[model samples]
Target: MTQTTEFDWRPFLLRWSGEWSDWSDSRSDDETRSEGDEAARQGRWLGFPPASEERIVAMEKRLGRQMPPSYRQFLKVSDGWQHAGGFVWLLAGTTDARWHDNESGLADMFEEDLDEDAGPDERRDAEIWRRGLQLEVESDATYVLMDPEDVDDDGEWAVYTWAGWRAAPPERYANFAEFMRDMHREFHSLRAHRTEGEPEFANDTTRELDALVEKARLMALRGEWERAGRTLDEAKEYGRPRAVGLGDQIRRLLGQTYMVYFEDVVTDPRYAPELLPSLVAEHAAHSYRDDSTLMFHLRGAGDDVVSSAYATLERVRDGTYRYTAAGPFGEAVERARELARWGDTDGAWRTLMDALPLWQPLGPDHLAPMGWVADPLLGPLLTPDRGRELLSTPRGGQAGEAPARSAGLDADNLTWLADPDAHDNLTSYRFVLVEGVAPEDLPGRLADGDEAALDDPMTSDEARRRSLGGQREFSSYDDRALMSVGRAGDRWSFAFDGDPAHFDPRRFVSPAAAAAAAATAAGAGARAVVVWSGLRTWRGNPFFHLSVARDGAERYAFTYADAEIHRTGEIPRALDPDRFFGSGSGKVEGEGHAEAERSLLEAVTGEFGVHLPRHAITNGRLHTFTSRSWTRAPGNGETYAVISLNLVRE
Candidate 1:
């Protein structure tokens, strides 16, 4: 069909015969479907017997023309074929192949709808459909039509595939063989998502090609990217169905190209940290909203990786952060920048590409040399080649240390913690600070019993799981409530623990109340201050509550849950509520409730001398404990929402 005399159909048809199934249910009997099994046992192809030369001659006499060379050769190999991939059930033998009957009326419909403004391709497609030979004996709303008028120099007719339901025009191919190859590829693509029980090709050449594609895949995963690229290029030459996509993948990793389809992007875990953020940014430029495909995969690299990327994006957009290159890579980037500034963008791009191999991350969040995206001089000059090169090159390196931070509290340092949408978890924060206590002692003091221990301190993630009762709906009424404790100076801070998504809503209500009750019970005359500040609740409302416990007794409490306010004791003269939530307050224009929450936190911390260091609370290995007495019991008449439940009568 491709006008190539060297082409052979026997090998491909043999492979198809081995793997073919009547996926369309065109064959009604079990005996017909069992032919392949019997043939496999006998070590022979299952294709039907080839058409004799006399049959071909008679069909040509009836049609008044000779069949296309490739199609004619194909008939000599197999009279007919089953499961030519997609919706096609079988190609017709010489006995049934004839001029189209136009029973579907698609040709007449398209002809009547044709407009004078239609393009050349559209007009040609309509003409092909209106007067073509039908080759399919059976199919599901699929047409295999060949046009004699659209013949090649070697008298090979152009083939067209059309589905009645699809909105697009008919897909044209060079000839019958090209169309069959595409359908074979479609078969592979359709089953690509399934990772189990891969099909074995019967033919040696097909088997070899499939093996090459898989080998390239494994090589890419092992960071043998150059080798994988070469393998994929070779597999492509062999006409492997998956080779083109796999080659694109290797190209993406090598920074020679980029993929619009994010799911197809497979990152080497070693380079994911360096590549994912830039990958996300590249996708973001083309997309209107965030892409979950790359974002979810990017998050697998590390905990702070996604957040750090977001911070970088925000800073870049706001013009506050600029990437300053370091080392040989940085010097090359500088040269590129200088060249770009001089209006020699091509030179700048070439300079950047040349330095890609020398690229190393300056810091953990130094995603890439992304200056080009933001640089006015270089932004306009970026082509797919240059952009993908920046995205995927400098592919391998361990991240450097983060920059040092100042000791005292900086407003900017609190921004990420304050923003509700910034991180996936810990959006709702509640902390209790008790004076005159050690970090380890806070856990014991805040628990009903001595269940809280420091001998086996768990990581924050482990503590979160234990606090939620280890994937169960309920723990015993006396089960401990997990909390993290750390010291900031003379005061110890006890935080309500567990990631926000995992925390049971029934257990989260008024956390300050339970925490205060526990703290003051063991206070021994010490003062404890509790505050729960949420920029936005699960219901999308801002909430705040503050309470104080002194000398083993609760003294004061105040809450601002959306529009309502509740107070338990006389407000402290120092904490003037009017100052924070006066007229034209609560929700400010442009800046929502984050500003209010931040200001209130600052005021409360300053007034009560409550301090929780940003680093210690967020990153340090603080002591973890669970309160044995903090438990909840719903009334018999009360309704509850739960993922799972178990009742114990012990």
Candidate 2:
């Protein structure tokens, strides 16, 4: 059905009532059960009998206005409804619906809220509340109102919901039909959380809608854009739950939206210059109405480089900026910017997408390419075929020069921690080593006997598969860490965890803290070392880190990336930088980065007397735990991103 069609509310109402009846039948309460039985015996459920046309017309005449077509038609099907939504006990029938008398001084409060700074929408919202018809017969300070003056061409009155407990302004709807349909979906969502077993709507239509959404998702992943768009459109008409999000994603890839933000997008070394101008312009345009000053608040959050970037973005947004990037991909981005300036969004998106796979980092600070598997818009565009080509193709070399192979680390040296596919473009791996801990006891120790460690242990492969499966719905960063644990050496235990396609350092606990926690979990005089090494997917930069902790305190941490070495805390002589690099200074003078990292790891293994069984890490199973115990809480300002590097170079 289309938006303009007279939506059939009867089926939704019937299904809702049926579900409620089933729930009622399952209830243990004697009074409620007897009431439900009496209603079933009387051939009636929760909904009221249909109102006669004459009765509806009389009520309309008394009110001196016509009720919205949707609401009037709804009364014809059922005079009133019970449990309209969230604590809404009863909806008004023709006999009960009336003009809301401002007895609670709600209109006065609305008027007080409309100060000199209020926008057109806010003013309209306040005016409607004073004049709208009240629909709720019983509620906990919640209201469903219809504004007679806010009529559409189709004679549909705008609906508004005002709840005293809600911190935000009243929510508005285009019409009653949309509101009811949303409530029905809300019913299903709520029921899905409270109960399980049968479908929310055990009908062919629900199954069809679900199947259509699933098909659209698969189509999008396969880069069947046009087909996926059309399928999602069809699913949206069916009111499928995931259709809206999928449709938004498709629209984003089609250049109908831009990914602009204060940090993630702007701080990204790639595409920031191309995207910041648009972000600034959009923020400026909406600042008056929404007060969402994303760019405005970024003043002085970083160094001169950040400030310079901001200034450049402001100039670009104001049409006074000048610069032309110098390479094939850069030139393509410049052309896209020009097309975007001329409002040729279609051309802009086409040019950008065509050059995306060829993207190389501008500098050492540009850690990864513009888009990879996790990007909501660009990711889907890089289908399996395109992805394979993108990964296999090497980037960054003199023009006409034969592409050289990437330097491979000697896997035999770090066999226990070596990635079998270390040369694979998308491969990433992480593991923690704790001294004085057993494989079976490590999970409990690491989690400090938290309930999160209560799950039956899983194998390393099984845990990795689950983390990468996309079926695990993590509500928080803490839920993101699911790791497998195993014995390393006689005195050491190792743990492994998987990383999602979207890697955010902010979502993780500090590497040092993670290492420290492992040591603490092993009790007195325990030592823990953690190592994380990986290449960002598809010919991206290599990142490697090593941290050591003893007796619950971090001792040393070293990071090798961004063309710089970051060291925290004093280096112990046993794992000395001079001995490992032979420079006597921690600088790579005459060796490749892969060799340097391998040498560093070799020193740590040789000194600490810690090593993992290669077979156990590569092919064997190990016990697992959900690693939420050490996850950093971003909301509490314990964000891993903001944590200082505490770099102490020696």
lDDT of 2 by residue, 206-309 (tens): 57667877766554444455676788676665555556545644453333444334233345445455444444444544555353356354543445436655
lDDT of 1 at 304: 60
RMSD of each: 17.4, 24.8
Query: Residue 122 in candidate 2 has what lDDT?
Result: 82
How does each model score on lDDT?
0.57, 0.57
The 10-residue segment of model 2 with minimum total lDDT is 371-380
Question: What TM-score do all the candidates reach, one by one?
Answer: 0.47, 0.39
Looking at model 2, the pairs that clash are none
For candidate 2, the clash count comes to 0
Tell me the tens digit of each residue's lDDT in model 1 across 1-650.
25344567887766655444332232234535355444533544545689999999999999887898878888888887666666887788888888885766776778777898988787776677557889877788898988888888877888998887888788888888887777776664454333345443234555776787676665544345567678777656545555664565445434443542222222333333334444545655555555465465453345465566566556433334334555776687778665443223455566766665566643322334443444333444455444444444434352222222212221222334565544456667666677666556665566645555652333466456555664466433333446666553344444545343222334443434333344433445566777666655553566666777765667787666554566677777665555565543443422556676777776766676555544334432345666543335655776656556665898
